[model samples]
Target chain A: MSSVPLPSSRPALGLIGLGAFGRLIAGPLARHFPVLAHDPTASDDSGIEGVRLTSLAEAATCPIVVLATPVAALPEVVAAIRPYLRPGVLVLDVGSVKVVPADVMRRGLPAHAAIVATHPLFGPQSAQDGLRGCRIAVCEVRGDRSRRVAAFLRSALSLDVILTTPEAHDRDAAASQGLTHLIARAMLAMEPLPTRMTTRSFDLLMQAVEMVRHDAPEVYDAIARANPYAEEVRRRFVAQATRLTTDPVQERDRAA
Target chain B: MSSVPLPSSRPALGLIGLGAFGRLIAGPLARHFPVLAHDPTASDDSGIEGVRLTSLAEAATCPIVVLATPVAALPEVVAAIRPYLRPGVLVLDVGSVKVVPADVMRRGLPAHAAIVATHPLFGPQSAQDGLRGCRIAVCEVRGDRSRRVAAFLRSALSLDVILTTPEAHDRDAAASQGLTHLIARAMLAMEPLPTRMTTRSFDLLMQAVEMVRHDAPEVYDAIARANPYAEEVRRRFVAQATRLTTDPVQERDRAA
Candidate 1:
């Protein structure tokens, strides 16, 4: 693992979203990078120290541009900033689902600018304290830039970088995260529970709730309703339940 | 909270089952009671120190009797011990579900012996070190004897006693424990995950597995197939899942 060298002169960093997750990363990253930030919802003057809140055109002046926008807003955000990106500038999107963002970047970003699509498999809750020990899946859309960004993440953030294609990332996530949140919602919907119950199982469910509870509704909606592969995983889970119920004997026999 | 008063002279205790749970309680209780144990699987010499393994006829000599057997075996065990029970002997069955055992004891036990059915709501894993702070639900069939046993558990074991009817105890168990174990098994069946791949949700699932993992096959069978109210809870859970899948928009709208 190559260490991300602290450049003698910090590279200019541009952040294009300022939601909870975007704000979380912006504060820490500004300490190392000269950051220019832009968020339509946030006032132009609103940004952390060392971060200059600027216009999309002004923010794109940086060598590294981060699309921290919501999944639904990514294509538009990418389109708005693409023309201003200089040659050799690294353009990256930190989103949950990968394939769509990767495609948007590949088609929309200027040919000169390097585009890398990645999913940091955690949220604001996990990143609220810090990003240590969390896994980040890097979908290499463009060659050397993806490796460079992954290397920077590994060395600077101490993140465990998993290299995989965007399609594979979405498919694996359909089971790992998509199915998990779905099950959690199902558990909460099953029955009304007393606030005081402290069984270990209940505690675990509460932990899952805490992980996804404060996420933007758009995140869940995108994963559940928009991710192409998620429905197949959900169908498989329901089919498993149906098999267990309808032909329990056969299920037991198959297990045996 | 009545403290368990140490008997001045050890009362003879009759134990009618010697499974893992039965053995755990029997060994400790023998130090305080002149224990007379009867289990078809164990010979007369199989009991621990201070416990006299004896025939069903000989076990009748004790004033306090405990039926520590599986739910399926409880009916036959209750019948065999009923004729031999002496008057005033407090007979309690420590089973997971209370309604059936309460009914069995009420219908089968001799009028002279008072039946006090209880569900400890915990197990060897939860209490492997000691029984302190655990919750025990006492379904009082015979008032005087039920108070005595509840008082003993509260005082001696330092347990939290929840006084409830057998019907209510079973109903709660159908949701809390039965549904918990069922969901756990479903989670386990979904993936053959390596221990190294543990997430918070997977760890929570493992905790559930650990709670029910040691249970006898008969225990699961009884909970899944025998508990009269459990099937209804399972059906309701499935219905809830179907509704979530079919009408998520309405559900989310209602939640909002």
Candidate 2:
């Protein structure tokens, strides 16, 4: 039942979740659509004022709904929003890993709705300046709207849109993102690292750590554990590290 | 004998052990002082052309001598050059680790000689463009020439000069440089990493690897082995990595 809106029409966009990433994208997205934002944790004490806040049902009634909640909460969010989603509503998700969230959205969303799963390859730290060069991976889950979405991302937002399936994105990301977070975590545990006599390479490595050190704990959880291929990548990394640390060839240099 | 070469007067400077680092500094340094370079392994077929390469004795007889050899070779080079050094000649070393090499140059050379132990904290890779902002640590070993050397480095090359003892330089560098090379080595073992769909942090981390990946094998040997504090740093890094890899609490996120 999910049908295309008028070609030139811009309908309201319902944004669910009000975390750091939620606020980062809301302002830019408001340019194209009237955004109705909702967050379960936002209250009088929360600093979520200024944006147009709405109830869950009202947000779901919009022409487009984006689930910005954590990946672990995707299933519950999907289930809660199901009863209120209008026919022809397009649902999208912004999460770190794609495969699990894509499946959850596909299984729980109303059959009449169209689903496009996306993983914006940047965060508040990386996109602090702007989103001109940021990349986002878009996968068509339940409908044919992903191409149109990717086109809008390229034209309106100046985003580099990579159209890939859930499996492919997770596989490549397991090695790149999974290893990055793991290394950053290990380094953070060894804080007060030397800043005085550092080489250029060490400076670069520390900058990488700075980018992800303040991220929410769940982000690390998703990259290192929630992703399907993360365990295999971690196993290979730890194995190589063990070999380097224990090898007798390395020992010969110790007596040099 | 190296008397005060007179203010604003530049004399011949000898440079020993012409490796990658030696060749890097020779051109810039030659602009200030007449350079005579010596490398024991250089042959006619080697790419040691276009520079004034001379015998070890001839190079060591200059008013000032610099040792650009690996730290592991510092003691031997110090012994071999001792008989040729002129009275009151100023000697300097550019090595990754300082304490051992500083000790070697101190004990082996004649008491009349002046010694300044320095680490350039950079390489051909980091200084590919220029050395305007690069850092060099200068430690006074035998005489008061380190102050003059530090001032010269500041005025001529625009280098950021850090004056410290060999022990302080090695202690900080053991944590910073030692871990960088170790991480780069571990990542190189897992090559063919994903170039597509990489996050910005991963890109920066890979750039760090590119900076040090092609460095000479002896560089790693010296940093990891010749430095006395490097073993403790490596042990701590490995222990933290092991705990992260095996922690039971992290397994809960796996079920998410």
Candidate 3:
């Protein structure tokens, strides 16, 4: 309900990763606080205009540092930044699945430093028009910083912030993101799908299919493997599909 | 490219089934020609206006009769109307699958009755905004009368008409319609799907799922079994899903 009260002297917002998703939020985030980014893979921040390029150590010491690294790289990134993190520095992770990254942050970061796990549900593709009204799942791990961040997201970015535990967020996300990517990948494997004379139902499926078709293979893997609930959901989906296809009596019914 | 030449005496368009789907097309068809419909299940034509209630024989005798009966009841309806169809009378079918219904018309109707198989891709739910710009697959079996009907559909009804063979239509439809319903039914089987915090991709899947969830079981059966190509498509889809879910390495890859 309350807005994120800006500090009298605004501190630089640190961004640890500069991948597609990281760059997407950088511009908007830069508007609120001066952004300083560090990406080991990039030689320079030529593409990202609004944010300044800085070393990992410099970015880590900022008042608010966002860890935007891949899920598998979380532990190493957390360890790398742990020594440089100053007391009361809020370390936020933008991981798709929160539980593991939240755990990694807790284990690596010092007790003096704050940790928060957040997943902005929209990507560049889904948020092409804008990020207003987008949903962002927030999991407050070790501080009251989540309230300030949630308020900022709601008031400044116009985001729908759902405050939840890391476990609940991953459970719900496993079904949503997991099943979607699985279906999209499977559909792409069945390419040259009939383009003409598509019914509205088939068209809707195709719309979803096209959205995630070009996603990185690693994204697919993470959703399928990292999220504890994904495997079970995938198993149940496949099992249902198998049962429906094999049933002879069910297939023999006449169409309306 | 040409408009249907309106005859000086506009003969009434006969509709042989007055179900929900039948009633959907009745209002539009009545605009071109006075519509007289007959349904064994209906006591009167109270729900749909612009269509008069008539006996089966009277409806069958019209210059243009649309057979909107269920796929299972097509044979009996064909036999019942065979005696009433006069020479040069155009008989059309609005069935979902073309092959079986086309064959039914060819085998049961008199040689003089011109048969045209049409599958309007949109149903009552999809056609709520009206039939303009909807896709309709047409397979002309026995006459040139289909050309006139196609022109009428394109010009007067503002329909996108795709002229195709019964075999081709059924083959493409098996993949399109079959895959959609299969996914919807399977998703429904996995009930209590997360209602909140859905991604765009997941929301699109749910939209397609909601569209077909209330469809008749017979419709599902017909698409699954009646269309010869549906089984092969279903088999491939299930096999792909199975392989993806089972591959451990694929699931373990880290997301970018």
Candidate 4:
């Protein structure tokens, strides 16, 4: 017999979505754990290997479960999978915003089930090269499984993991991811921008914009609307931009 | 005598206004021509070799004179250097804006003077290491000397040169440079920005902001106010940004 463990022998991981993000992680995750992926709306198998396309309840019965659904569907997904979670099972979420997902999973999952909220900062375009060196924020809502998750992310995936609270992650994400998506959206709206006769800075700015240009509309919405502090940060940026553009001289004076 | 030409024996280039930009170009151009630099408000030597800090009239008498003064001071500078320009003398202005400076120099300078409006699309911060591969826009306002200047820029400095009229240069720059500075300014106002927990895209965006953060006030002013198309571009960006932030969901619908 071969020394490598067969797909049936490896520990099973229930992945509860086969959307863009779910498919993105499935390939990498399947290397460590045989992924039992479940998505009610998925029509295609996505050509993913080492992943068994299965039913939601069967997928949820695995010892480890990952809710990779959109931020808006967290509550319902949590409720749907609650009946299948075994005691001491590890449950995690991959969402754009952490605060709401952490709350929903914490309130919905059984107390014996461990919950860790994560947000991978890089998208498909950026991670097109690979996921190594990418950033992911992990917050432990229940149990001490966060350390194990961080260890796995560090050793197995080579990811930069930040151990923070739901509130801290959301606060920082509101300014970082929220502003990034907002600016990317604004720049995209002003398309056909000058490509020739450009500066290094403008090129860099456009590169950043290009990275997020193809992200799903729901991703932008979740970052800009779902996170509580996102609106405030965006408002502050807009006010600053308005004052700077409307009376540029006054803005320059203030900046000086 | 040594085979190397003595500093005094080399052809001279008159550089007016020894501000940040003036100092930046002094060393590079000093390699090709001995620079006669004059700044009325100067104090320190800046430890630059092969440059003589002389009076305005003496510096203005060089075969090739470069106006490195602020855009606002272009009119007076052109008028002051009018009587000193010799026949067939190639005079150039290194200002951020082109149309007004081109007009001012063309009307003020003697017809014998060859007026070429140039904008080196880089600042001290961006060119800290060196100027290889930097971009410079060359606009021929008066005579045929722009072709020679373009060849020298490409051969000697390894710069990418774009040959265009003053109007086209201003229009493209108004969008590229104007929007860049506007975004940089707004981001700066929201300082103490997150440096840690940043994605590659956010890092790229911040790096672009950092590249132009230390630019002189005149640079921003010239790009934003002097370039005629700046106001409309700024208004468009602001309107898009305002709508995106005020009701992000509605903005998402519109974007869809």
Candidate 5:
């Protein structure tokens, strides 16, 4: 895929949500783009300069509009932006689960507006590092303009872009993110935090805790409970555990 | 819990087993102490000096004898050294499980020799950087002389020592070592090795693989099978998994 450099004219960039993740992205993107931000909850850009806090209609005037709202707020935000979106506006999302948002963006956006569903794998916790060497999943790139958006994300941010359909993204993520967080939560539930530990096992559990500790509780719950493919992977992990207990010899043999 | 400083005249240290872990300790200990090493399998020391090849009886002549044998061979080694142990000698072991070797040393050794069971919570692969901050469990220290041994391990080797009974050591280790290695083996068995992975989950799994990969199959089997307390902890891990699947609400409630 051919990558496009960041636009020379500093294209107007609209960010719809100003939560932790949206703020993180907007703070950095403002330095390079003429960022027009809108959030019902946030009044102004407190520290980020060169960013214009505008209404939904005014923000929609930008060439690239990013919907950084949570999955629960995505449908409403998509409906509100649909009427104001310019014909060739590049609309993208940063939601965790892609299938629902992809459907909403495709159904609600103007016919001429390009809908691109992208998930930046790292969250606000890692945003300060500047997205270098991180992976971004590009799901359901519908138009020629969407390809350019993906290429810009790759070239400008130095992100490793993996191209996959929305269904595939959700399927793999069910195991990779959803089930991992679920397992970590399960481990935390099983025992009290260790008072003293030094073994490699304890170190692994600590690593899991560190990864999921600061994530939004709702985000973890949605990933675990809402993703359709997550239950199967959870079931598989449970089955593996059962085999370890009931028929350990068979478990050993299988592993062997 | 008084500790004695290491004597100016460090005694000859005897290492019986030459497996990966035993060699790691023996090679390094040989650097600091006069080491009498014997392995039925390994031929060369790879140029580590001050190591004398000797029979078990000749090695037992040292006032401080370390039984770095495998768990399965520990009883035999204890018996072999029983006849040669001199008065005031300190017989210590480096095994994953404690109760069995502690009992064997109690029943098999001469009354004049002191028996101390230790579990250094690291291995050759994980301890490659040296045992600077690693924790070592000293189980059922017998005599005043055992303090000198503990001091040498702590002050000289910079190991942190946790004092506990053999039964308690086995109980904790069954959960810590046995369950950890079991889960790692299970995870490794489940997935195909990724050609390229950057996610934190994959990195955690890779760390688990690094910790357990070089372990002897016998060591894995011994941890999984020999410790009687292991089955209960393994059952708890499996139960936790089942609760996550069959009743996630209960799991989340418990976590809360």
Candidate 6:
């Protein structure tokens, strides 16, 4: 393995939650900043070079800390890191739903600590090859550190950053990610799909289904129930499907 | 285009519908046999290179006749061409749902006429690039003509021919094609999707939505409602989705 770069004046980047996503970003984050990560469930040996699996306190003390826990766990995680945060330190949480985590960060973190709530629009499946050109949504909750983070993501990781509010993110995600995972789950429940005699559309849906089929239960909860707009979006989608199957003529006429 | 191939000992391939699909297959089918096509809506002169736009009676007289009509129109179409069919002529209907068309062909067409129900899985959108590896499901209804058609599809058009029963086709299709178009329609109804913040899964869904968004109402009707199994598949899918959004933890536990 390449030796660690010469120590720079920039403070270390702390990463919490060494799950799939945390591990995905660890190497790239470690390349730029000395990454100290901690996960209660994870063993001491991460196998990823240059990453130091440290304590929660040590992980929170860095100038830039990324909380990569599930949205359900964000409240307790935020509380745990709140006391260890230094003034003006940037604290970002990578959660699927923005509003809940954004609010959690706003209420739990100190005003002096910069809070940026982000949802990396991809997971391990989508970014299997690399993170270059992947999308990430950044919602500024506390301070003006979004631009700095955006610049860092763009330059260091080559991510396409979308700067928006937590409300806007959740609202749009209701139709995008929320509807996507709902379809995936519903289709999985309706299992034993035809392996042969598949069309391009069915194949595409299968690919999308494969991406989210193994997602965590908490992740499903976050996207399906936690986001306020997701339920309504799913309702609208189901109502439209019902129309297509029930009054197909009227549905077709409207679509036409 | 190169000059039309010499007339062979084999009789002409009669196409009784000159709609988009009729036009799509005309060029490829013409390469193998003299294509005699007729559509009440189409003009006498087809823009296709070698296909002869002929009368319904003349088109039905050929040894191989393909009924490329809507599922709702199959009864009348089968009846209209019944008298003109030559003995042992191959009569096929290219409809989305198989059971209805298979029944129509069985009851309406002559006993001596060979009947096959086919569903070309790819459309103009899915087959935009080419039909070399596209899928076509062939369900034999009467007589032993599926091999004849399968050989033609495999050798002439380079299609992937899936041999199965009309019942099997409809059963699997209700979940695969029916569910697919339903999702596309529902997503389209939820319009103005965030184009900027899309994941690979969402993007794949969007591509699928794009594929079926412009499908004709008659086609949608056939796939969504006409197939006997489609309504049940759709009902189960919606029930699962409702369960997911309303009680995600319960849904997750059940799935787990």
Best by TM-score: 6
Candidate 6: stretches off by over 4 Å: A1-6, A253-256, B1-6, B253-256
In the range A4-79, model 2's lDDT, one tens digit per residue, is: 3424366888899989889888888877887778887776332333346778888788999999888888999999
Which of 5 and 6 is ahead in lDDT?
6
On residues B1-256, what C-alpha lDDT tens digit does candidate 6 reach at each position? 2224437766788898888788888888888888888899988688897788878888888889999888999889888998898998998888998998999889998899999899999888888888999999998899998998899899989999999999999998888898888888888877888787778999999998888888777888898778999888888988888777677668657657
Docking class of 3: medium
DockQ of each: 0.30, 0.57, 0.58, 0.72, 0.36, 0.73
**TM-scores across all candidates?**
0.84, 0.91, 0.93, 0.93, 0.87, 0.95
Cand. 2 TM to true fold: 0.91
lDDT of 2 by residue, B168-202 (tens): 99989988888888888888889989887888999
Quote the lDDT for A245 in model 2.
61
Accuracy of chain B in candidate 3 (TM-score): 0.92
Better of 1 and 4 by TM-score: 4
Instruction: Report the C-alpha lDDT of model 5 over A1-256, residue by residue, as the tens digit.
Output: 1122334587888889878888777866777797888888776543577666778887876788999887778778888988888878888898777787888888888788887898777776544567787777887555766567668777877778877778878787776676567667666655654434348655775676567767776567556765667778778777776666665546446668
Off by over 4 Å in 3: A1-8, A248-256, B1-8, B248-256
**Model 5 chain A poorest 10 in a row by lDDT:** A1-10
Predicted candidate 3 versus true structure: per-residue lDDT over B1-256, tens digit per residue: 1123334368878899887788889888877787878987887543665677788888888899999878878999999988888888999998778899889899999989888999999887778898988999988999888888899999999999999999999989988898898888888888888877678889999999888877656567667777878888989999988888887235434331
Q: Estimate, for each residue in A1-256, the C-alpha lDDT of model 6 and write its tens digit.
A: 2234437676888899999889999998888888888999888687888788888988898899999899999999989988899987999988889998988888888989988999999989999999999999998888788999999999989999999999999998888898888899889888889877677998999999999988777787888878989888888887887776676567657657
Among all windows of ten consecutive residues in candidate 2 chain A, which has the lowest summed lDDT?
A: A1-10
Root-mean-square deviation of candidate 3: 5.0
Error at A67, model 6, angstroms:
0.6
> Which scores higher on TM-score, 2 or 3?
3
* Candidate 1 C-alpha lDDT tens digits along B65-96: 88888888888988888777887788888887
* A1-256 per-residue lDDT for model 3 (tens digits): 1123334367878899988888889988887887778897877653665577778888887899998878888889988988888888999988788888888888888999887899988888889888998889998999788999899999999998999998999889888888888777778878878888689989999999988876655466567778888889889999999988887235334331
Model 3 chain A scores worst on lDDT over the 10 consecutive residues at A247-256
In model 4, which runs have C-alpha deviations exceeding 4 angstroms?
A1-10, A41-46, A254-256, B1-10, B43-46, B254-256
Residue pair clashes in candidate 6: none
Docking class of 1: acceptable
